[model samples]
Target chain A: MKRFFLSDLLAGLLFSLLGFYILFEIAYFPVDEGNIPGPRYWPRLIALGLILFGLWLAGSKIYSRRMTAIKPNLHHPHQRQVLTILVMTIFYILLWSLFGFFIPTVLFLLGTMFVLFPFQPKQKVRGSIRISIYSLLIALFVYGSFYLGLHVPLN
Target chain B: MDAILQAFVSLFQISNLLMLLAGVFLGMLIGALPGLTATMGVAIFTPLTFFAPPEQGLCLLLGIYTAAMFGGAISAILINTPGTPAAIATTLDGYPMAKKGEAGLALGLSALGSAGGGLFSVLVLALIAFPMARFALQFGPAEFFSLAVFGLSMMIAVSGGSIMKGLLLGLLGLFLATIGIDPIHGFNRFTFGIKELVGGVSFIPILVGLFGMSEVLNRILEGSLQDKVLRSKLGRVFPTKAEIKRVTPAFWLSSVIGVIVGVIPAAGGDIASLISWEQAKRFSKKKEEFGKGSMEGLVAAETANNAVIGGEMATMLTLGIPGDAVTAILIGSLMMWGLKPGPLLFQDHIDLVYQIIAILTVATLFSLVISLYRIQTLGKWILKLPDYILNPLVLLLCLVGSYAINNSLFDVWIMFGFGVLGFVFRKLKFPLGPIVLGLILGSMAEANLRRFLILADGNWFQFVFHPIALTLFVLSSLALLSSFKKAPSL
Candidate 1:
């Protein structure tokens, strides 16, 4: 079952599904006053393309998968890091919305730098301080340049 | 003629000149970093650039564009890794030359050759684009529609060997582009009752996501925090007259090839360099001297790759089509600043157009001098910077650029969504070029198509009679067919 659903095939099916959804939504648009084709026309054209291409991608891969004896590797070494970054990003955005720009931005910068810094098990104290100072400098630079120098109200 | 004079004066202004230098220095930094592409750099910086006066903003953008191309040569020469994709070929002979302790000479020649090629292509661009714009000024809705179609055809042609994936992404872009209110009609199409979306998915956020955030995420996934670099000490960096004479013919021919390929839409510097390298190998008197630190190989690759800049600007300014991914972001920035990049720009802001040309010329000189002066010291410092710090800074910048554009939190979320999409597309080998190209041109193509339909009065076939329209259609078809037979262009 896993082999039956490849990435390309999944992308293809999703695209086709989105195309169909949009095709159905085109009906909700108010009617065109002119006798000519309306807002629905372009969407219809693209919907057709999506369906055709999606089918092509899936069918081609399905045929090839049967011929080849290959299994896709789904695991990656940096999966935890990637997920952590994504969580941190969402939290930054949430923090920005709750508080004004400065605190959230500074915290986000520090957090990101800390996450990215490769921590050694033995030499923790020295590395932590270096990254902390570096993150503050970067945050200050960004704040000064964008807000003070250029009058782009960060908040 | 007066417009040209004014353009020269405008470019010589102290502020404009300062911006040019700043852009070049920043571009050099970005290009010297591995995993930070010129396209992504330009895209990330575009929103911030918009805050400047239009002319100065444009100068800054042009500086970044040209210098980045030259900057790629730095990493390619010092380390085995290319700073940018355009410098991939430069690494072949470049690293070898460095191994023999001629890193300075190699750097000097690359900078000199790149400047020469850039200027040569600019000359051709000046000759060709204005006339082409004048010719296109006579076009009707049908003709413009055909031209837009022709541009879309470039999506598959440069899909990196996969037409299906390119077409899929292109179609996706076209569909997403339809999210705003219909051009001809007043009704909203895909807003889903959201007021923010009524104006459509903002171009800045999308660009930030696809190019900027996606890069940061990918680097995070790779988890290589430290820099893997060489400690090559560059010596005496000016090219001898004899060395210049030796590389001149190949340099000249490669420049020509670069412009042709660049003008073809989607065929970028990487493709031009590869093709020019092959042609140089065939044309060289010393065929056996190829690839083992051949001066001709380095010259051809660097010259042709940089030459693509001028050719790209020509297409982007004359037509609305992008010459490459970087120009696609430029188009987005142009639109953000309320300047449409088409034939109308030539008529309305002729001086501004010429100013871009002048800036390109000046940026070349500036980049050449800077590269020759500081290749050894600056290259060492840049190569030492670790990825962990750089990637986070870029991610922060991308966030600021997105949020600051409209002061909208929604746009940031939009950027996040597209970043995921871009990552998936990259992993699946889908070309990002078509997506950006399609998004930018989608409205233009759709509006023109509808206009043509209305003009023909229900007779779709009759509108194809215009010679330009017919010709464009034919050319697009031929391009599509050729793409099927050939390797990926861009």
Candidate 2:
């Protein structure tokens, strides 16, 4: 099942499903005006393409999987780290909208960097201070350049 | 001649020159980082150009485009990581040469090859662009539609894994592009009542997200967040007279190949370098050393990739069709500056076109001079920077840059959504380039298609009567058929 998930079969199925949905949705758009292609014509053509190619991908992948006996190795060491960072970023964006830029941005930067950095028990204090300072400086720079210089309203 | 003189005069302005230098320096830095691409470098820095005049902005972007192509070689030699996708071929011989303790020599050869190739392609552009623009000006609606079809057919070449997957993604991009107001009719379609959707999905946000934020995520997932690169010593940087003579044939062959591929829509530096490297290998007497540590191979790859910049610019400037993803963004930038690229550009803004030529030439020379002086030290320093620090910084820029476009958090959200999609797409081995091309060309194709139909009065067969349209359609078919052949290995 894991091997199947890693294959193009899943992608094909998903795309084909999306294609059907698009086909259904574009039905609401008005039909072509005589010869001139209306709004629906282009999308209808694209949706049909999606269906055709999506089926092709899935069919090809399935055939290849049957022909071959080897299973793909899908191990990833940093899955947890990646997921954690993604979730953290969501929170960071939320905080950014509600509380404004500096504090949330500085914390997000410092926290992400710390999470990414290799662990060292003895150097934790030093590393923490350095990361904090770097985060603060980065935040300030982005704030100054984007907010102050370019006049982008961060608040 | 007077326009050329005025171009040079404008180019030498203190602010323009300074921006060009800064863009070159920044491009090099961005290109030296593994996983960050030339497209990403251009996209991330695009917002900065919004503040400047068209000339200065173009200079800045062109500097980045030219320098980044060369900059990828730095990591390829030192860390065995091709900093940009274009440098994938560079790693074939670059890493091996570095291992043999000739890192400096490899770097020097790469810089020389890059500058030589870039200059050759620029010469071709100067000779060909005006004529090409004149020819393209003759195209009617049918011919234009067929040309767009031809451009979209290139999806197969850029499709990394499978042609089917590429076509599907291309369709998806086309669908996404149709969300805004219809080009022919005034009716709104697929907006779902969201005000932001009426203007269509913002190109920059999607671009930055797909190339930037998704890259950060992918790096994290790959556990390459803290790269432990083994440092290589920089030895003698300059090549000997005999060595230069040995590589002369490769330089010529690769540059020609580079320009040809670069002129084709959707075919970029990565494809150009791979093809050039293969061709050089076929011609080289020392073919056995082609992938081991051959100077010819390194020079071929670097030269071909840089040469692509000129050919890409030629197509973009003359036909208003992007040659690759980076040029696609550049087209958007040009549009933002209220300048339409095509035959009329030659008639109306010939001075600007001349300035572009001058910028490309000067940028090549400047990058070479800098590479000769200090690229070795710069490469070493870049290799030492940890991804932990770099990734976060990039994410910050992605967030801010996306928001800066419309001064709305909505664009940022759109970027985040696309970033997630980009990551998922990558995991599925889908090509992102097709999506970009599809998005960029969708409206043009759709609009022209309808116009051609109207002009022909409901007779679709009239398309076959137009010689240029028929030729383009034939070429598109051939390109699609050629996709069945085995692609060059990365």
Candidate 3:
């Protein structure tokens, strides 16, 4: 929670810096006097307000740190499952770009099922295989719908 | 009446009806998938519509627009994640219902509410579109600028928990809007001389990164180990007569609010839903049941969001100005077909306008039917598919989606870069929504400010002294100030 507070403070400081940078840019622009309001006027005002607000956020968070944690669910430790999914996603993207759409999608679906929900006593190998086949069918169906049916011209 | 008859004649075409169904079905699927928002769905599909007649193409897009709003509720009910930002409010009540094993009931009420809202809004559009368009024609550049400011102020309404965070994000969005080439002088502001920066950041890529990639990264970091896969029992997918009767008034009210808010260039489905929910909460005798599986809340949000489609379209069709990002793309699609939008458009191409409106109305109905029937069975099956298999495929789609925008490999890389940035932001708990909004709106904001300055001869008073502009300036300031006061400290 303290880390969260500190991070927010840091974000506020970054925004404040950005606000000032904008202000600096506005300063360089020549102001036209004929118009009711100059071009830099409103932007400068907004920037000033943002700077003030950012400073306030950074200042106020220094004293307030009461973290309320929600109870951890049973599936909290599936970090590998998440990582595997992310890696698979990157692979899927690269594969799709190199080898076209359908092939990589099928491979991704099969690979994911094999890794994430590996056969267990309660979850039989047959069930996983059936799920994989069904997933493939769904993927193919989607491919046909989007690519063939809609003519997305997937490269 | 004449326009309605003409619209009917145009919509009666078999091809138009079929395309409407296709658009609705595809939109629902896209909406049901977490991170594939309605805007993204519309953006990806808008190009495909170019081959068809403008009416048929618009019919399909309208179908997608309406159905996608309802489609987001599917994931919100079965999974805790909202498929679209508009469904964020829906998830508050919907996920709880799913947890309590009332997923079927939640879906039923959502569909019913959505249909009611859609039907109501279409009727409004049918009756009021022309008049509204005529009124909107009176708006000058200064008025339009004020309108943008007013629209920007709604960010405060969406800011939940920390007003400071929301303001920070909103400002961040405004800053990002300033990036790329200045609209007035064509001088690059923040592109850093990068050729890719000249066009600024593409909305589609940034959106894909912020919503899709960030979600994947968040899931990875959070570690999906503890997610108990709740198998939602497929029950009767229709609300009871009693439930329908109770929600009828809320549906009507939300539709009215949705259309009114959506007609404004700055306000969108998200704001419309928020306003409707607030209104529903205020009026409902069962207000306590809200955020705890109240059908009224789901109905209000779903209906309002769907209703926004017609409302937003009214402005786009009558005036050339797009009400939201999706509409902006839709405007591009129409322009690609050599169809101009505005009063002159209606006068010169009345049949085309009528055909398009007819297609939209029919498509809205078609979207309702497909969402109610086709998605019920598919929704149950989709819920059971583990995210491990699904998330990767979505990422691929996102990559293709980004690349497909301009057929540039560079955009794909930009998407990946933003994805990494999004991940870092997520890790640091910095909100990403405003950043995307900023990037999308930056150029517009800067251009208008510059134009206003040029017109005013650099007089600072011009922005504040002009009646409409002054009101907007004050309103945006108040909105920013109020949001700061409401922030919940970490």
Candidate 4:
């Protein structure tokens, strides 16, 4: 079975590639003007730093890996749960942008509570309604205090 | 001086006093809650200061900052869960002490140590702030650039592991800083046709996302296995005369270390507490008691973390550079309120400076009294709060906090992006602290470097002639190499 690149060496290699891409982008930047170091000069130096450090990270990591061949634990037991939360967060943001702050926040909070604390199999309805009410109260309290009282203009 | 008297008068106002006490209460409560850090508390509540007088706002925020440091010790002692990052060191001895049925005594020592260390740092701040500000007033761009370099080098010591990885992230941060309009030339550098990027990345979103939302995500994945409190019933919190005599010197020594660490830009309580705990072990005759519930170790952690508040306040109030992320947000909030912090602040807002010192003092005393007499009740309340509820609330706070900064959804999107970045970085075993430090100091470093280059007329090697800059470079190199030696093997 093939595994995703999840080790320090891989992360280092990816970062180094990013450094090279940044340097390549600097070619499009304007050059030195009026004897001053141009717009790209500082970025160039930083890019060099990124490249050097990234190489060091990858090189050192690879050197270490040769000494000890260990598997990168890519999958946690709750990988699906984590994915669900991340997706829920994305949807929550979309809802907030599309349908103003309060509605989305309430729904998001309610949804997150469920995602976080799944309803018990025996008392699913009671747990769901109880959690929903708690979310609503919290939503109102936070919104009223920050939005209404402090006039944060969340909408 | 008249300003001092006037400051004294204003600080004693009933309204200001109430707010100061309220800030302490809120700080303590939030600090005692696992997954709710002092940084998150300040970042979330900073916007509320918009409606209050600057003095009141300062009181509330400063109160929270100081009290939160102490508040974390409560949970550390009771539940073995550090409510805030600063309390991590405390859990070593504090929780063991609680397990031995000395919860009340542990809380008492922690409270007194916190108040004492806080007071000592405040005195250090009072003595050093003006002198430091005056010295800072002489800084040219070259010196400032070297200073930023020195600060960046601190990532080696601060990253907690992998110096190379820390430097890589720091360099990345410096690169990210270059994304907005070039400070000197006024030309857009890397906006990439996005309007929001022109102002540079909004730090509020990054801060809230990395500290707040990512933490929530981590908790969501932890799946609600909660920590149980072993001892809810607390006894009297006062130390005996013999015990006080034994721990007093360590408290003073740790407080000194705390102040020094706190004054350095980007350093914070976690480092100070950890260092002080080690130092306490070295200095103690009872060194064998270190991880086995030593009262001295608990004192060292509590006192040192509290002491950081004073040093942090000095750094923020004088240098316009923050000691940590919380102080960075504090500096931002100050700018939001039309108050600029620097040497000029010390001279022009003399009364406000004095007022801040007063606030620190009062907040410390209030936290001490509350922690001593009320810790039993507070500990129970803290244990009652569930992590699952906190997870969702923190996410909501992160969402609202990011949105509240400029009332922009773009910022919220940025928050979302940084949350993923933070979570991924944590997963990849990279230090998240340096990224924030890099982001905050990035523009400052770039601006100073460019300005210094222009001033030196591109004879860049001439930077070594400047004594301060040269010293800093030397120190930075030393720090970098030292951190490399300290980096653990893979």
Candidate 5:
């Protein structure tokens, strides 16, 4: 299946199911006198509309067979980088919980920069050092504005 | 006239003026950065304004809102990646300009166009806000319902290649909106017994996940690192007198389209930019230059996006109805200041409203100055930071930002869950904006529909026959029909 069609079909089905679930619940939960359409009426109607829409999408996709071509070049390759970043994020969150705001932010900035931007073929060492310094300064400014200047309670 | 003069006096107060400048500068800085959007910038800074007087605080946020839209153009010009969703159209021409070594020209045009758009919309807001608010105050539940439906119809027009997908997402968003406490009855609907889910999903967390986290995940999967190239030294960044004359028509045209679209509840800068870009293309003298470094295309996109800031605010201040997500947050901020926004606000606090309008105008001028003087150096420095270092730090900020919203760890988890969901949806090529729109408008749509049905004794034809509702319904149907004609198979 073309990814777009499949995604749309799944989303439509999900909504339709949710709508049915809401409708089923409304049977037990009675609406009071002041309420006009009751709790269930609008949701159930919207749900019905969704199910029909979903079915139409699925049927059309099957009949047309005009799936979007997935381009291979669009996929990201740096899985390890992303995983590393996620791990660092977890560490920072924990550090914030334990040590407070300023410390963890500084550490994350330094640690991630070190791991990610090792010397490339065209990169100059001097330029890299300069960038590291500039990054540190920017990080400090960000921390100062949010934590100290704004006086946000970190702990 | 005296009220307007008093408003200008308040706006020109040294402190308020300083805050406006600072707000615009900060907005431009944050907006130009990838992964940081206008909504996030506003949300994060909202708490900071707690210390300031209400007008000053509002002025600051308003400045940030306007400048951020313009700031997005910086990244669109220098990098293929748009700093905000509003800049997506800008990249069609801007990136082309940068690639052809006209980065300065592209940035310059964007700044000029943005200022013009902002100024034009502010004028519109000044002229029409009072009358519009009075008109909106006449709206009953049925009318509100019709408006919401009309707004939802734009989604069909917005579905670039797939109306089915757009509808599906819109439905899904509506479903998600049902997860919280029932608006009228105070009964829980779809919380599934989770206390955290009772407040409904935080829009910010979901937005952060969909835009910020999804981008990170996509980058991870695409592992091809962005090539870092030094900005090419080029000709004068300022447009020549002739170049200005060439783009003047597009600027005015886009500004008008942007303000009109922005006035509609739920439609925002992204829609405005897209619509304006299409219109500009339709009317351009050099239509073939589009997507190939055409200055007119860049001007239209930038102008419309910035213009929306003023137009959106006009509705928010006048009618308590936000035109987009950023303005929705601003509504929350306004409520925090104990200012009840709506038609009565104009009657009760006309001076404050005028001051806000004045501040918006001044802030746009400040944004122009800051962008012209500092953007080149700032853009270069920002783009120089490696993604590895920057992405992790931003993730940490996201976690903290979500946690800080309500001081609940549950929000953190929600942010992560939405992030993962956003990544998966992005992989499936689903557009994220419509879903957010659906969530925002879903409750309003549901509540009003229910009320209207009850008022009409459960007659659905009432929606079809009422003049305002009928007009809105027809317009919405036409928007959907146009989309279908453009892409019939989907």
Candidate 6:
């Protein structure tokens, strides 16, 4: 089995790549027009800072890892649950944009509640009914406040 | 004295009193909801005030401003989320205190501290507004740049155990601030071909995502649903005599910090609260307990944030300069009423100034009474809600709040993205506070530095010659240097 310190290394790598990308993009920015420094100055300074700090973070982590032989815990018990919620939320947003606010919000709320609710094998029907009513109420309350009262046009 | 008497009498009108009460109630609701800020509340109601008489209108707006600052502490204490950005520092000790079965006491103390700070700032406004406004006007581009540098140095203090990771995120926030058109040349830098990016990132969405949505995500990942019992425990609402005695000095000190920071144009409650929290920690006997639920830290944050309203009012009324976003909207509203705000207007409308002071005092007192009355009931109600139901509701609010900011789905997407980003940062042990600090001070730092450079003909060294700027630079260096000794190792 292969193992590595994913958290620190990944963060360092992510930031370093972002820094390089920003540096690349800002190259096209107009240079100093006169005595005043141009748009590139501030961004350039920050981009350089990102690069330096990213390397420092990664370098420090590597040094620390060499000194300590500790195994990192990478797996979470509820990874599947977290994934389901994230995917469901994405669908909720998509449905929201397509079909407006009411139906999507109710569906999203119901789905999340079902996933999050404590499992009792004997009371599935009751749990479903309770979650359905709660979801409907929340959606309606949200709709009334945002769409009717505040006039947010929740489309 | 006669004008003060007349002003107090004017507040007794049935219509005026109703408007004040309504504003206070509405402001509490707005402030307790995450993403709905005091600025938004004031901006939304500004138009309504145009139809009312001067005294009544001022009363309503001032009531909202006063109560909203206090209201933010409600959500911060109850949940780990801050209702408003001004309450960011409140989450440091407030949430811990809530989790420790002192939710009631936290809310009560927050309300009292907020009222105390509000009253103190109002006194300052009444007695020394002219001098304070004059001092605020002395902050030119160079001075503002220096102040922002000092503000950025606080990122080191807030970085928690990992200063390197904190500074990295802070730099990233600064980079994000440069996405819009350049401040001086009007040249687009990093819009990435999106028209919405021209406005740069909206801070409210970022804030909601980072603090509110991320919290929900973290709870879910921790399998909070499996726990049958809610964690928060309702306890005593009021502080004991000894507790009050311990926190009184913090209240006074932070109130002064809040007023000074508030009087500075472009600085607001958020910055004041942060500085107050740090300074309180430095001076406290319980320094180690600061982030772990120190009463002094909580009192300092709440008091400072609420106190900012008075200093902002003073600056707006005396110098025609807005101290923050809410005050900027207030200035526009006053102009709509044909009430010019500068020295000449004060001489011409001394009676109106007296009336404003009267309105502010009453509003502070009214807010305190309402907050104290509701603290226990609100804390109990929130603690009663289950994690499954409450987490979903919080997520919904986060979505709605982010969307409500610009009526743009892009902002919603930004919120979702940052929520995920914040969750990752949390998992990776990076401190979130410095990122926020960077975002808040970034543009101010960049724009003022450029302006100062232009003023000095690119002579950067000339900045040190200014006494205030020099002093701020020295303070910033000292703060950053101190971080090395204070920050814990990974």
Model 6 residue pairs with clashes: none
Best by DockQ: 2
Query: lDDT per residue, candidate 4, A77-103, as tens digits?
Result: 455667777888899888877888888
| Off by more than 4 A, model 3 | A1-4, A16-56, A63-155, B1-18, B33-40, B43-60, B73-109, B174-180, B216-247, B261-302, B314-356, B371-376, B423-433
DockQ-sorted candidate list, best first: 2, 4, 1, 6, 5, 3
Q: Give stretches of model 1 more than 4 Å off.
A: A1-5, A31-35, A66-77, B223-227, B487-490
How many steric overlaps does candidate 5 have? 8
Worst 10 residues of 1 chain B by lDDT: B223-232
- Each candidate structure's TM-score, on Cα atoms with residue i matched to residue i, is 0.95, 0.95, 0.77, 0.94, 0.83, 0.71
DockQ values, each candidate? 0.52, 0.58, 0.30, 0.53, 0.40, 0.43
Return the lDDT, model 5, position B263.
83
After aligning candidate 2 to the native by TM-score, how far in Å is the CA of B258 from where it should be?
0.9
B1-490 in candidate 3: lDDT tens per residue?
7877968876777887787888888778767876667766676666456457777787777777777887888987778787778787788788887787778788878877777777777777666767866665665566666655555554443434555665676677676555566566555666666787676666566656665666665654554422543564746677778988898878888999999987776467878888898899899999998989888887888788878877777777775656776676676567657777765676678787667667666666676676667666768655555655555555656666676657666677777777766776666555554554444444455566667666777655766666866876787777656765665542
Candidate 2: misplaced stretches above 4 Å? A1-7, A63-77, B225-228, B485-490
Better of 1 and 6 by DockQ: 1
Off by over 4 Å in 6: A1-6, A66-80, B1-114, B121-130, B222-367, B371-376
Q: Which residue pairs come into collision in candidate 4?
A: none
How many residue pairs clash (N, CA or C atoms closer than 3 angstroms) in each of the candidate models, in the order given?
A: 0, 0, 26, 0, 8, 0
Model 5, residue B15: distance off in Å is: 5.1
TM-score of chain B of 6: 0.63
Q: What is the lDDT of candidate 2?
A: 0.85
Tens-digit lDDT string for candidate 6 (B232-305): 55678789999999999899899999999887655689989999999999988889999998899999999999
Q: How much TM-score does chain B earn in each model?
A: 0.96, 0.97, 0.80, 0.94, 0.85, 0.63
